[model samples]
Target: MNQLELLRKFTTIVADTSDIDSICKYKPEDATTNPSLILKAVNLHENQKFLNQAVEYAKKKGGSKQEQLLNASDKILVDLGVEILKYIPGYISSEVDARLSFNQDKCIVKAKKIVEMYENQGVSRKRVLIKLAATWECIKAAEELKKDNIFCNLTLLFSFAQARACAESKVFLISPFVGRIYDWYIAQNLMSNFPHNEDPGVISVKKIYNFYKKHNYKTIIMGASFRNVKQILLLSGCDRLTISPLLLKELESNNTVFNRKLIPPTTFIKPPVSLSEEEFRWEHNQDEMAVQKLSEGIRNFGKDQILLEKIISKLM
Candidate 1:
């Protein structure tokens, strides 16, 4: 078997794309989309219908031009999500508008709206994991949403503080960005050439996975934003991994033996104490890399979301 097949035996594979054709080709158990991926999907000729659906939904919903644009933008995400869900048996992570990442109430409201749009199209909320920034407010928003049976995937997680908070909040999953973390270190003069298993991103996810397992946290640790196939291979036994189609294609062609590098801790490890919001902010701020990356990730997501809205605006 190719590495992808071998790895699937131990880990759940999630496709990280909004292009339904690629999702169909990879046949990932679940799929995830962000503003950037959704923007890319909007450019796909085949996904044009979803854009039209968004416009129509926005028309019927009826609002001011800006509000209508916002509605249409969100509609595109759910419209695409509903389409992606038809192929995957598990959840489809459609992100809440990243612009609302810092506002807990707004994030919660938008998340519910996204789920409502999905339900309107005959999809259940159970299969949709709303993606949000791992900001304190966003995590709290997720905490509340979970009570309403809306599962969340906390994205842009870089520090242990974010992971710990999400786990304590009983979120459905946390996507620790492997490649972005590695990129931050590289910018700080860390060497790019290293053994795959020893990569810092791999090490970060492994640490989180082991800690979560040792303490028995139910929140799934999915390694995301991989830089290469090796990074994905190193995280072989993680709960789930959302990989891009390019890397997925690479793994499918290679015959490298997949090894289970990360495993749940067997020897008892001490569980770290939970963090209060103030404490969480303090701890997260101390990690310079995490602070910079979290901000950068949010800005990038917000920027891409704007670009997506611009596309929708043209159609309007």
Candidate 2:
């Protein structure tokens, strides 16, 4: 069996892309998209139709310039998600605006709007995972959304504190970014070349996986942002892995003997105490890598979202 097939025996493979052709080719169990990916897709000629539809809908819906822009942005995101969902059998994550990361109420409102837009298009809420930053406010917002049967994927997670909060909130899943974490360490010269087993990013996800499995927490751990196949191989038995199509193609072509590196332990262990808002903030602040990466991720996503909106504005 190829590496991708072998890995599927232990982990649920998720395609991390906005390109329809890639998603169709890989057939990932689920699909995930963010502002950045959506922006990339919208620029493609094939996806411009969705952009035109969203802009036209926004113009017809008629509101203030700001409101129209917001509507067009959300519409385009949901439209793209709707199209992706048609190809995958499982969930497709649609991210809330990165600008709402720090605002609990705004995050909740935007998430609901995204879901409602999906529903209006005859898509089921069960097939959509509202993606939010792992801010304390967003976590709190997720807690509320879960009550309404609206599941969420807590993303941009870097520190254990973020994971802890998401787990405590009983979110459906948390995406601990492997590649971003690895990138931060490498850029800081904190570590040089290392074997796959010892990769810092892999180590972080393993720790979170162990903590969840040990405590019997139901929250799922999906490792994301992999820089290489080795990083993905290291977390073979993680609950799920959202991989880019580039890496997916690599796995598909390579027929290697992939071994399961992580498994849930049968014996239960005491979990760490839940963190309060203040405690969560302080812990996040202390982790230099997490702090820097989370901020940078949000900024980059926000910038892409603005660029996407500019494209829509041009069409309007």
Query: Root-mean-square deviation of each candidate, in angstroms?
Result: 1.6, 1.2
Candidate 2: tens digits of C-alpha lDDT, residues 3-28? 99999999999999998899889899
Question: Candidate 1 lDDT, tens digit per residue, 40-158?
Answer: 88898988888898889888989898898899998888888888899999999999888898999999999999899899889999999999999999999999999999999999999
Which structure among the candidates has the greatest TM-score? 2
Candidate 2 TM-score, C-alpha based: 0.97
Q: Candidate 2: misplaced stretches above 4 Å?
A: 193-197
TM-scores for every predicted model: 0.96, 0.97
